[model samples]
Target chain A: MTENRDSIAEIDLLAYADGRLAGDPVRRAAVERHLARDREAARLVADIEAQNAQIRALYDRVLDAPIPERHRDALWGNAERGGGAWMRLAASVALFALAAAGGAAVGYHARDGIDVPSSLIERAATITPAEAGDATFALASTGRERVAGETVNLSFAMPDLSAFGYRLVARGHPDPGAPNLVRFLYRGVEGKEVSLFMRPRMDPGEERVSTRTVGDVAVSYWSAGPVAVAMRTDDPQMDGIAVAKVLKHAVDFARVSVPGPLDEAAPLDGTGAQMAVEAEAGTMLTDIHAGPSQLQ
Target chain B: MNDDVKWMVERQIPHLRRYALALTRNLDQADDLVQDTLERALKKRHLWRRTGSLRSWLFRILYRTYVDNRRRWRPERMAADPALIDAFASQPPDQEHRVEYTNIAHALDQLPDEQREIVLLTAVEGMAYDEIADVLSIPIGTVRSRLSRGREALRRFRSHTEGAAPLRRVK
Candidate 1:
């Protein structure tokens, strides 16, 4: 305990007071013993620590304040004006989309231990077989949506995966208790199925795309503005990144049609749709492919 | 900038903003200072040596920006808005914390800018002596001396004003 007792210096007092010496117990104990007999040094150390705590208490909360969106825009500057802002935006959205997918996996309550609403799984299991055809019907869960105490009409078109060789064969709310929850069952060749789930998030979150395997089902999820979408497909060979890219673009495009307060609360500026389209058309398109590997 | 670079810069904004606020004391001014810092950092992104940390690089940019711009503005030292402070507090602070906040805010404002910067980087930001030296472009010896003087001055100010109401601007 008295190992470094003689090595304590004026500088060590400050270090000990600021907790820089915390990892070095011998030095810390030496400083403590120095403080035991040296009342003035002890008072100085106490005051220094007190000052640190007070300063931190006064200002640390600024960290919790969401970075002002304009700064986010500024950091990723405007791409069309010759900066890669949209790509940065897309990259960020892709990052969060992946995060939300993980959260959805947990919320979904998947058989591999990623749990979602079991009722949705049950409904997907019990869904009646559709008559044969390549039909793409859009099912929208539209209503006067209330967010943060104000009613706003929120509508975003469900992704059409027809290009991916899948056609919407059925549409309805899988969870009746959650009327806002709508599911579109898409049937591809060989009876392959991809169910797209749509719901309005309670608050607008950053846009992102992430995927998780729910039992045999692969769930690709993304959220933009107030709407969250999860594309669940059981086909192992399915190009999920391509489907997610399509879903993300469709959802971002639909935000252009969502005219009202919802856009105001969105992470992007009022020109979010334009930005989203630019992001889709730009480097982010390529960037999204690189996302799943980096994120997973 | 690349997405990777942009994200790296983006992550450091809050810390930059915190240091800027500590330096300037006014929110709008702090934000403006940080905005300038980010602009400069982006413009000179090539200057950042990958050998060093992004946090230290950003802090270096921020400190230099503060030094370069200090002469252009009139002394408009205002207390952080009480309501802003109230919002920042996790729970409502009692009368004692309010007094403590006022005392330290006043004491901090009174320090020479050099000492104050070192004190804050050391105490508030929890930067090491060498990191402080790197950020300020000073020697480790200078960092220690300035920090010692700064904390001692704060302690002296507190002792002299014990049991007294610290003066606050009425904004």
Candidate 2:
């Protein structure tokens, strides 16, 4: 609005400050000349640029943070789970389930006294091989436990922890009442426990993979589509995030749909206690055994 | 579904994530937005027209998904997410200026959702006015005015918060 040709409007000056006026050299030059003479105007532009820098510095690194693996697996994984007529219905139900589950879990835990993380861990730790007999029908054991409305895959392939020299240890008996939570435990060379818990989420709202330490145990949790998965370990050095991602990727897409375990599919719900020792012929067995610390 | 579309969508993910981060201001929320956007785009990949810029198309989907979710989780929550802000606020010791940096996060957070979206699209993603209009399905004039008001609002916020308690980083 300034009559003087050299003077700049606030909008034009701001645009110029943001490098948005690059296509208009004449106007930009006028603003530059005005700022050159008016230290006040130059200071405004500098302040504006500084804000821009702060905003960029705050967030741009996310672009560099390795894309969380579950996200990547959703895009590229070969085994697809949720594309059925059931999936469309399950998608809405999953969302509803998520919110309902959260509310129910809070109320249920308050009333029935189900400790979410600990009970899950403790129960998994207590279940005997005979108790985990459901893993025998590896997939069926999980599939059979589904609630009437639950249609998503409830079981996941045991993550090939062989890369870290860990072997299948046991499958925990999910509380019959809260049958959604499936636990697969693995053990390292020294018998350290690493448990992967996979549950088909009814909650549509589960998004981020979060990690926390319960006592000395490190727990990492995230959701992929209809499934929510978490991996827990006592090993402090295991990048819980990376391992959680691996498990999430497996839980979401690489679920072993056809029967047949790594060695022999747990006979419909008579799954063995120590699976690594029972690993069937042709089951993958990685020779490179390293502690969780060597995951990198 | 086709390889080219797949590759292009994959490449735009970083840019989408960056812009989403600027809008959501929470890493978890931002990544979730990107993931949701990608899922939708892939599911409806057949609807994609080869005419306009792929970036614009992807951004359009992303913005729509974000708006839909925000509506579902209505009453916009611009709560101070220290987890995200502190990541950047952990910069320098120039006490006087650190105040402005802190205000920067507050200012962006406080901006109305539309203004925040318009401002970040222009400032972070460097979208042209027309491109923004295309992304948000608004006129170019609305884009220009919203952006102008957004910048002024930010400046006002910084000034108002000046000399307040020293901003601190949390983890």
Candidate 3:
């Protein structure tokens, strides 16, 4: 009889850990009462919770990655049409621009509008990369006292992804709607647009690259040293992490190439920069197994 | 396919892709698996009943597709790296948390395919036992037993590596 009760208790313990017993307050309290006396069962519950967190930490970013272009094309039938598709693409881009520009004000009007667009803008600004689109222009416009006197150039030069068949199309400075954000738009060979929103990193320690999908667009955001960037791309073919590696490698190289005036102005955040470089190298090593090189 | 079904199927793509990636751990293969699943689902759209959960139906198709092509898509599995765990462990408590966060991927990769699928569907996909049973076409009792066994395996794996003694197994 004792063994039978214990067997049922064990199952209840598993159900309790999974919140299966939540709907039944009587059973939940009973399980809680049992857990208070059972140290091993308590530890088991904690382990399950920790394991769940770890599993999510590992794979939840997949939700943020853009759906593969093949899948999107397969479903939407966009890949079937050639010339007509390009016209539609152009129209969509025009529509997006108009909506973004006009909706900038709408974000301020309604608190709920802060979700997709405004939050993207806010996040870009808050994590804005130090260097805007142009390295030279960023240095000069940032003010001589701040740039030459006290701050490292820490310019995040945009990678020339022409190697990957993407060309820079439009660059937007922080407008009234989106403050302290720099937006870079890149057009892919297949008429897909990849937009990168960048801001300065306020926290040096937060360097994990995270991806989020808002509606049809995928946003990959990470901070490296003084600058932070979020690459928002709707191009189904775009691999967010690979492109981030390219950007990180470019920024690391830029840091090495910059002249001494900026170097002496401020002490470099060696740790963050080193971590970024190491991460970039680690990713490059893994890229060997990532199948064909997107870089032609 | 009709627009409504297409829209419903499209909404479930991310969930399907996430599950596929968890199963394969290779991006290219996961995407291929997803592509195949989508194609199969489209072809069989006529059989899908409107009353059933589309998410469960889509998952069932994806799971079946993965099982059918498992051998072809199975990449070389990675063993858990103790040195990596040590590096994370040597840090402060916060870094120890990093060990917990990062090492689980390796541990998960080491789990048996059946256990890994059950664990992922439960933890990552947030599927209920009945739903999981439906998706996998297993009995509800099997779902409960598999989930318990999977969680126990994960707990033991973590506890063993961290040098902590795990509780005695009830089963």
Q: Write the per-residue lDDT of candidate 3 for residues B45-69, one digit (tens) a residue.
A: 7777543456778889999999999
- Assess every candidate by TM-score: 0.51, 0.48, 0.49
- Compared with the true structure, what per-residue lDDT tens digits does model 3 show for residues A185-239? 6665444566666554333222444554444334555654334677655444455
In terms of lDDT, the poorest run of 10 residues in model 1 chain A is A91-100
Model 1 score (lDDT): 0.58
DockQ of each: 0.17, 0.09, 0.18
Candidate 2 — which residues are off by over 4 angstroms? A1-7, A79-296, B72-81, B88-98, B163-171
Off by over 4 Å in 3: A1-8, A79-296, B79-98, B165-171
Q: Where does the lowest 10-residue lDDT sum fall in candidate 3 chain A?
A: A99-108
Candidate 1 residue B19 Cα shift, in angstroms, is 0.7
lDDT of 2 by residue, B70-92 (tens): 85423334424454455534343
**Model 3 docking category:** incorrect
Q: What does candidate 2's lDDT look like per residue over A1-296, in tens digits?
A: 23345557777766776665543445666887888798767766765666666666556566676767656665656644332332232112110001111111110011132123454544433443444434322333434432343222233355655434344545544455454466666554333456666654333222344444343334555554344555555444344444544454343333223233432344333222221111221221121111111111
For every model in order, the TM-score on chain A comes to 0.38, 0.39, 0.39
lDDT (0 to 1) per candidate: 0.58, 0.54, 0.55
